[model samples]
Target: MRIKAYGLVEFTKSGYVKTQAVVLTLTVVLLIFALLWQPTGMWAANPVFGFLEWWVLLVLIAEVAETAIMLLKFKEKEAALR
Candidate 1:
């Protein structure tokens, strides 16, 4: 049996996808570090740790938005091809 797929391969090949993956990984690591370093209510006490956590969250949101846009574009292109 044979199967055909569209858009996914091209989507993965995009440079932005790779960049987003890296950014997501780094943000996750930063989030873990922030949580481990301060397990309790320390955001008010520690500005740097709080800032790091907020920055990681914002980056994650941005990455998700970008990925969604890219996926929509790929879908539109594939539909046009068909």
Candidate 2:
């Protein structure tokens, strides 16, 4: 039997990479919809959704940026290990 070895950083990075990709894709789609959504639109007429749209986008952007920074750091760490 063969066993695979992984570093702590590598494991952490692999976990986050998949999650970040999914979140980023969903965020971009949501951002586009938010940008195109109108306050008067039937679905978005709710004051809460209209008011929160920009905030939601800002939060998502911050999250994605943080994930990107972490990914870059992880890559550097992985490179250093080699």
On lDDT, the candidate that comes out on top is 2
lDDT of 1 at 59: 74
Query: Candidate 2: which stretches are off by over 4 Å?
Result: 1-11, 40-48
Cα lDDT of model 2 by residue, 1-81, tens digit: 111223333346666777678888888888777777766666577776776668768879798778767767777777878
- Model 1 deviation from the true structure expressed as Cα RMSD, one decimal place: 7.9
lDDT against the true structure, per candidate, is: 0.64, 0.69
Give me the runs in candidate 1 sitting further than 4 Å from their true place.
1-18, 38-50
Inter-residue clash pairs, candidate 1: none
Worst 10 residues of 1 by lDDT: 1-10
Best by TM-score: 1
Q: Per-residue alpha-carbon lDDT of model 1 for 1-82, expressed as tens digits?
A: 1111233443343655676688789878887776566534755567666576676777778878867776677667667779
